[model samples]
Every structure is written in structure tokens, then in C-alpha cells.
Target: MSRIFVIRHSIFAQIVVWAIITAATITFGLWVLTNATIQRTNRQALERAVGVDLAGMVDIYASGDKDELAKRIGDRLALQQRDGDVAHYLLADAQGARIAGDLIRWPGLHAGTSESADIYIDGTNRAFARSTQLAPNLRLLVAHEYRDLGLLLRQVALVFLTGGVLAMLAVALGGWTAAHRLAGRLERINAAFRQPDDAALEELARGSAGHDEIDELASHSGNALARLKRLAASHRATSDHVAHEMRTPLMHLDNRLVKALAATPDAETAARIADARTEIRGIIRMLESLLDIAASEARRGDRHGLAPVDLSALAARLGELYADSAEESGHVLQLDIEPEVTIDGEEMQLTRLITNLLDNAFKFVPPGGTVRLKLRKGPRLVVSDDGPGIPEDQRESIFEKFSRGKSCFGTEGAGLGLALCRAIAERHHLEIALAPTDGGASFTVTPEFQR
Candidate 1:
């Protein structure tokens, strides 16, 4: 039973149920109201009819012919009671004596000089009565029936029930149509997502757009597809660049090792061999950095490890280390850091991000240029270089894996520095922005701690 209900249940079902309930409530309410109104009006009409009959009875008794008056009253009662229109009749004297009528006595009567009283007669209770004065010594009473009013109300209730059922059917049909249309759109979107071919699925998802729920589903699907495509492209480009960059250094090292093995060398040649080995080690370090970036991107949310480190002190130290190099190169290196700005992260990765930015800046900046580093509040870091600035069009693309700007074409590095920075920032839920500078590039990093 539960499974059946689940299969049949939908928004349309709910709408139909609500409509039926509302219709039933309204129909029952109106039927009850109409019946009460009609019953009241019928009772009043019966009372007026009994009043007229009493007037006629008074005239008959006033004519000084008692037998004729009794006969006439009996005849009128027989005519009204024959077809079940009037149910019963009664007559009474001032002394509460039953003078004429089918019932021998009136039950629940109040003794007062009143003109009329409602009384139940025979087995069924459907009667009205009125009393009149023929003389001071004699009183006349008349009664009438009103059972047909109940039958009239029953017929009206039947009509209301029929109309309510029809209204419910109409509402149900409308709800079903609406739900079917909405569900069809959703089914199409789901099917598109399950398709094997990426391009075909994208086209199918795009084609669903119209002025309906299908359009909204299509829009969201398109956005998801675009993100997936971008991630895939970044991954491929990073892989290719890493392979090519590592291959060059490895080939040079291989050739140098071969030469070292073949030469009849003394101390100087041995020193040259050692230098080649160091250069190869530097290449290995750079390749490891690239691998770290790829790993970070692949598992951005996975917890690896963490340590507490002072970011501000680290930034100041990096500035000091680069200061002599900047002076010898005729550029100024300035640092402004707030103390005790500590955070929990992989210290090595953070240091690599800072080192990459500084190295890129130094490589691009000419003589008389400046590199500025600022860290504050444990959450914000700014690095600005007075070098050739990135063009507006290239700024957005420069952070993509292996995407190089004009100034970086001849630089001694694969273009993974900015990409790695971006991946690290994302892993920490940080915002990184590249801003335009007067004569160079400025980058701002806002960590999640600040938010």
C-alpha cells in the first residue's frame, strides 16, 4: 500500500485533494445554509396560512349554525390532509378542552390568552396552529401540516452533491495536466545528465530551454558542464607542461653524467660534475612543486596535514632575504607585516606560493623597479611588483594552468606558478584577485579567516 501511494503521489495529487476538500466544505456549507433559510421561510408561510384558516373558522361559527360550521371545517381539513401536504389538524377551547381535531389533547401546551401555538400531532411531528375568538365564551382553533418542506430540502441536497462531484473531477483533470508537463521537463533533464557523450549531453541540456521549468534545469546543467570542461582542460594543460619542462632538465643531466663518466678529470672537472648534479636537483625540486599543485587540485577538500606558522613573520623574512638581491638588481624590496599573524596550514606550500610570486616579479621587473609585500590580520596578503603589467585581456587567463602572459614567454619556468597559487587559495577557501597597477602587477589574497 505504501509503495502504491508513493507511485501515485505527486504535486498534482496534492492539488486535487485540496480542491476536493475545499469544494466539499463549500458545498456542504451552502446546502446547510440554503436548507435553513428555506425551512424558516416555509414555516412563516405555514403560519400565515393557518391564520387565514382561523379567520374562516371564526366566520363559520359566527353564522349561528354549529353543524354547518363543523362540516365546513372538516371538509377543509380533509382537502389539505389528503395528499400528505398537510399532516394533521387540531381545535381547542379557552378552557384548554379539545373541542374538535384528530388528537384528543394537545401536549406541552402553555395556558395563556395567546393567538397561536406550534404542536406536534399523531405519530409524525409536522403541524402548525392558530386560535381566534368567535365570542367571549367560545374560541376557535385551526391547524395545518408542513412535511413537504423536508422533502424539498432533500432534493436540493442531492443536486448539490452532484455538482460537487463534477467540480472535483474538473479540478483533478487540471492538476494532472499541470503535473505531467512539469514532470516531463524534469525527466528530459535527467536523461541529458545520464548520457555518455559529453558534447551530445551538453547540446541536449542546452536545447531544453524554454519559458518553463525546463529552461531553469537547462541553465543549471549548462553551467555544470562548463565547469567540468574547464577543469578537464586545465588538467590536460598542466600535465603536458610538467612533462615537457621536466624532460629538458633530465636530458641535460643525462648528457652531463655521461661526459663526467668519460672524462679523465681532476678536481676542477669533478667540481663541474657536482654543479651539474646541483642543477639537476633544482630541476627535481621544480618538478615536485608542479606535482604538489596537481595533487592539491585533484583532492582540494581532502585533509592532508597542518601546522601552526606565523604568516606575518614569514613574509618579513622573505622580504629580508630578497632585499639584497633587489638592491643588486637596482630594485627596492619593501615589506609591511603585522606581528603574530598565525594560521594553521602546510607551511611549505604557503612558502612556495610566496616564493613563486617574488621570483616572477624579479624576473619581469627592470632596473629601478620595486616589489612590495604586505601581510596583516592573519588573513590578507598583498604582493605588488613595479614591472611590466599584465594586459587586461590576459589577466583572467594568466592563472589557468600553463597559461603564460607576454612578459613570461622567455622566463625560466613553466607557467604553473599562478595556477598553483590559485589552487592553494581555493583549497583554503580564499579569494585571489589580480589588480591593475600604474607600471606593474598587483595581486591580493583574502583568506577565509578574514571572511
Candidate 2:
């Protein structure tokens, strides 16, 4: 694999690359060492054979006459040649004259010492000679063909190199497979982080079934997710309690404001009281939206009592309910409904989601503009309006609580409508997105039903 691709994907691929490089480096080093060792051993064995042969020739020269010594050397050389051996022998007299041997000239050597030298014979065939002195004036030389030892070492090196390459290939293949599997497992865990919930967190643990490093990481992640869920549940309960307690006081305040408005005779004081009542009502609505968000989020991953909602009929009914309001706003209401689109979801939340979209559409579209509501075969709900479309930059942020677009500054909404819609859609496991359109703002909610 290419380095850029591997680096972009995962750490495992880089590790595999390093492992193969290290293996190759070690193998090359071993081959060099082994080749040197074999060459040294072969040279040493050849030197020992030459030493023994020179000593015997010296003994024959001392114990026999010169002719007998020459005769003995000639016999030994002849016997080796007959056997097709590459061994050569040479013995010389005090005057450095040619003696009985295949080698023609006497090699230069120090007396009573032994050393190896390169010698050529029979028209430039090279041999390795071990030269030894038999006396102050007499010398002996024994040579073996250099090609034999060189060829043997080459064969040994070739075998070792071939085996090492095969082993490296095998190891690399195995490591690549292992790294690929590990990277896939890690990717799944990483994806789980994007939508952190009990089911997604549990999925990581379920996938990591083997007793490996990835499995251990999954185990730890599952525990952390469990702890986080517990903390969230506790916080939600506290918020609900606080909101509930505050609602009673808010209701009492609303009642007192109502009575004050009734008792007050001054018109200016009544206006102030009515303004306070409206502010209080807005606060109550904001609090209720917060509570709804918490409740919808808490219902995520809950499967008990979930039923298939008829989205087509629901959209048609909601369209009828909002049609007169659209007409009053001087905007045409259009419904593109398929007959029987159904999905598994909470019916109340689905109704609220549709209601919020219709409300948003009517509030935004200019007079004489058209609002289109679609329910299709995929159980998808799309709400689009022809108006100054939502800005590209604000489409995503508009779904956040109290996040209003620049064009919506003068609008009457508290800005939790879209936020509530999002929470409801997520609770139903739906895919919600703001789609790009030529002349309007569009939102689509598709049910990601478990099938």
C-alpha cells in the first residue's frame, strides 16, 4: 500500500509497514554475517589441508633422496589429477628449479612460514595457494581451485536469502490482515462516539468479542458510557423536579396578575399588568419546551409500546388544520401525500413534529408564497416554503434552542420550535436535514426505522 493512504487510514497500517522494513533489515544483516562465516570457515579448512600436505612433503624430502622426494610429490599430484580434483602441488629445489608438480614457477615465500596467495595455472584459471617453506632454500605450495569454495558459499547464501524473503512475505500478509481487522473495529467504536447513547455504546461492546487490545478498550468505553448515561439521567431528573416546582409559582403569579388586571381601574396599570402576564406566559412556554426536550431525549433507545404511525394520514390531517391559517396568511398550502406510509414511532411526537414544521412554514413564507408538505413512500416528511430562504450558514444552527436566523429577528417565536422538532425527530430515530432548494427553505425528516 502507498504511504499516504496508509497514514490517512490508521496507525495499524504504519505499524505493519515498519514491521516489514525491520524484518527486511534484520534478514539482510543475517545474510551478510552468514556469508562471511561460511567463507572464513572454508578458507580455514583449505589452509589446514595445505599445511598437512606441506609437512608430509618436508618429511619425505628429509627422509628420502631428492629424486625420491620429487617422485613422491609427482605421485601425489598425479593421483589428485586422476581423481579430477582441483588440488595443485609444487615442490622446488635449493636453486628454485621446477620440481615435480603441475605449477610451473616457484611462489615467493618467507622461510618457515605459511600464507595464502592467488596463483594462476593452465591458461588463466585462478586458484588459491597456501605457500609454506620446507627449508631455507626448498619450498612447497598447495592450491585449491577458488571457484569451488566461492560457488558453495553463493549457493548457501541464495538458499538463505530465498527463505528469508518468503518468511517476510508470509509475515507481512498475516500482519496486514490483522491490522485491517483491528482498524475496522476501532472505526466502529469511533463512530459510536458521534451518537452517544446506550444502544450505540452497547454495540461497541458486543462487537468486541475477542480477547484482544481492542476488546479491552471497548470494555472500558462501555463502562464510561454507562457512567455518563447515569449522570445524564440524574441531571434530567433534577431539571424536571426544578421545572415542576417552579411551574406552581408561575401559575399562582399568572392567577394574581389576572386578578390584578380585573381590580385595577387605571388603564396604564392594566396595560403594565397585561404586559407582565405576557412575559410570564412566554417564560412558562420556554420552560415547557425545555421539559419537552428533556423528555424526548430520555425516550431515546426505548422500544416499549412503540407503534407504527400512519404518516400519510397524519400529514394530510395536519395539512387540513394548517390550510386555513396558510390562507389567512395569503400563502397557498400544498400537500403531496402518498396513501399509506407508516413507520414505527411515537404518534404524539410525530404529530408535534409535523405541527411545528407547518407553524414554522406559515410564519416565514411571504404573502402569496406557497408552502409544500410532502409525505412519501419512505415515510419521509418534507416541509418547504417559498420565502427569503434560510441562509446557508444558519441552516444548521437554527435548530439550536433560542437560535434564530438574521431574517427571523422580528419574528414572535421563542426559537425552541425547531429545537423541539429536532428532539422529537431524534427520539423517533429519524434522519432530519435542511436540503438546498432553488428559491426556498426545505426540511426533510426520514424515519430510520429498525427493520
Candidate 3:
């Protein structure tokens, strides 16, 4: 039963039902008023007819012609069948004995004033009676059939029912249409809130602006998404900061241990210590790079205060710095930079970004391979290497924090370099992309970024 109620009492159905009820109430009220007015008008007309008949009867009595008066009154009433309910009349004497007409006996007629009552003739036909004095010793009685008013009332009720039914149907249809329209809008709002993820939420928010309830719902959803994004960013930043800060002391300890191990005198013991120190140094370096990445990310907000920095000069410096290391490792480091190309950014961070890219390229390139750094006035920087290039699928994943391609599994460095480069590029609003190369990977950084 509860389930049935739920099915039947939908918003549209409820609206239609209420509308029908209201329409029925109005129709019934009008019907009652109409019937009362009609009955009142008919009653007034009947009263006037009775007065005229009484006057005529009194005139006949004054002329001492009772028989003629009775016949005339009966003929007059039979001809005037306007309602067909008008009472028949009879003349009676002071002793309550009927003198003429169809009345069998006069039953206790009142004096000095008119009296009305229901009467029956032959114990069958029902009628309404009114009696009045015709003279000092005579009276006139009139009767109308009770069924006449019943017939009039039945006709009025039939008309009222037909009209009321039609009006109720119209009202129900209109109300249902209005309620369904409102429900549809609410359903859309509910669907928007049911989005599965943030991207879906953002898309829904973009589509939900208008001068209605749906618009209000969309605006609220957008605000909630924005707050969630801010909270996630804040949490990430805090985690990075804590990890970076904790690594500094560990790095210092590892550096001290390395120096102590280098000065030991026992050959076998020294060899073992040296190996341990090397592992510690690797850990130290990884920690330092992690700290650098965190610090760079922290200072990202200050990128807007950057002045113009020369990319060519920066590239030349890196080339000179890495040239001897490349020579020792049997690889060539080349620079092909145009002079005076400038960009707005923190010079220190850009230098670090370029240095990391070059270091990464050199690590993958084999002996006799070339690592080229090119800076041009197209206001762009390009770094490329003739080495085993990153696989197509791994290129995008490599830019994420701690993500490394299969080729770099045994490499000495943590995989924060490219991630830091991406962070820096984002901070400076520069466009960074990997260009597809046949033999090796190439990367280009545009001076101005647009999203």
C-alpha cells in the first residue's frame, strides 16, 4: 500500500489532484447559488399568481356567485401551467366544510392571516397549501405539487454536474503541466550534483548558468569544486616542504662520512668504507636534489618579479661547465646558441632547468654521442641528444615527480630533474614540449606560454 501511494502521489499527480479539488469546489458553490436564485425567482412568481387568484375569488364571493367562481378559478389554474406545480383552489365556509372544487374536506383552516402547509389529496399526490380569507365567513385555499420543485432542481443539478466535470478536467491538465515543468528542472540539478569526479564537476559547472534554480545550483557546485582544488594544492605543498626540510641534515652527515672514509689507511677496510661512502653520497645527492625541487616549487609565486635573462649566455655557461666532464666521459657537448635572446624568469631557476635537461641527455647518450644545446632568437631553447631516445609512451610520464623511464633504471640520480624543469616552466608561464626525433629525444621550451 505504501509503495502504491508512492507511485500514485508523484509531484505531477498531486498538483493535478489539488487543482481538480479546487475546481470542483468552485463549480459546486456556483451550482448551489444558481439553484437558490432560480428557486427564489420561481417562488416570487408563484406568490404573485396566488395573490391574483385570491383577488379574483374575493370578487366572486362579493358578488354572491360561489359556483361560477369555483369553475372559473379551476379553469384559470389549469390553463396557467407555467411550472405545472401551482396549487388548485377551493372555496370553504366558516365551519371548515368545503363548498366547491376537488378538495374532499376542509381541515382546520386558520383565520385573520394566511397559512401555508404540505397537503395530500386521496392519500397520494403531494402539494403545498396556502389559505387566506376571501370574506368574513369564507376562505380560499390553494395548493401546488411538491414534485414540480423536485423536477426543476434535478434539471439544474444535471447541468451543474456536466459543466463541473469539464472544468475539473481542464484545471487538472493545466496543473499537471506546470508541475512537470518544475520537476524537470529539479531533475537536471540533481543529475549535475551526481557527477563522478572533479573534471565532470567542472564541466557541469560551466554549463549551469541561467536565471533560474538550475543556475543557482550550478553556481554552488562550482564554488565547492574550487575549494576542493585549493585544499588539495595546499596539502601537496605542505608535504613537499616537510620532506625537503628533513633531508638537509642527512645530506650533511653523508658528506662528512665520505671525507672520513677517504682518509682511512687500511686497504681492504678502506675499500669497503669507500663503497659505503659512495652509496651514502648517492643518497645525499638524491636528498639535495629533492630539496632543490621543493624549494623551487615553494618560490614559484615569485616568478612574476623576474627580470629579463639571456638564454644564450646561460647556455654558454652550462656548455663550459659540462665540457670537461663530457670529454672525460668520451661524449661531445656542443652549444649552438644565438646571442642576445632574452626571456623573463628567475635566471637561477632557468639555469638549473637547462642544466638538468642537459645532464639527463648526457646520461642516456653513449660514448662519442653528441649532446647539443641550441638557443635561438626565435626566443626558444632546444636541447637534443644523439642517444637512445625516450620511448613515445614514456615521454609524458617521465615529467611527473619520481617517474623514470626503463632506460634510466640504473642511473645515479633521482628522477626529480625533469619534474623540476616542468614546475619551473609552469611558474614562468613557458611552453615546454617534447619534439619527436628519429634517433634521440628533443625538447623545446617556448618563451611565452598560453593555455
Please name the candidate that would achieve the greatest TM-score relative to the true structure: 2
lDDT of 1 at 59: 73
TM-scores for every predicted model:
0.45, 0.51, 0.45
User: Each prediction's Cα lDDT score?
Assistant: 0.71, 0.79, 0.74
Q: Looking at model 1, report the run of 10 residues with the lowest lDDT sum.
A: 106-115
Candidate 3 residue lDDT tens string, 1-451 = 9968964867677768878998999999998899889877776676666667666667776786677777877677668666555467777888877777667777455745787666786678766677887767777887665545677788889998999999998887777777777666665455544432566556656654455766666667666755755675686677667666666666676677667776876788778767777776667666667666765665554443689888788889888999999999898988888999888778988988898898888888888899999888856788899888988788878788777754443554567778888778766777678887888889888755431
Please report the candidate that would top lDDT against the real structure.
2
Q: Which portions of model 2 miss their true places by more than 4 Å?
A: 1-226, 298-305, 406-409, 447-451
Q: Could you give candidate 2's per-residue lDDT for residues 114-193 as a string of tens digits? A: 77776677858676787766667677777776545666777877887898888789778988998888878887777665
What's the TM for model 1? 0.45
Model 1 C-alpha lDDT versus the unseen true structure: 0.71
Q: What is the lDDT of candidate 3?
A: 0.74
Model 1, which residues run further than 4 Å from truth? Answer: 1-9, 24-30, 58-71, 78-81, 108-118, 131-137, 149-158, 190-451
Error of 3 at 107 (Å): 4.7
lDDT of 1 by residue, 9-70 (tens): 76666766788788788888988899888988988888888777766676777775656666
Residue 127 Cα positional deviation in candidate 3, in Å, after optimal superposition: 3.1
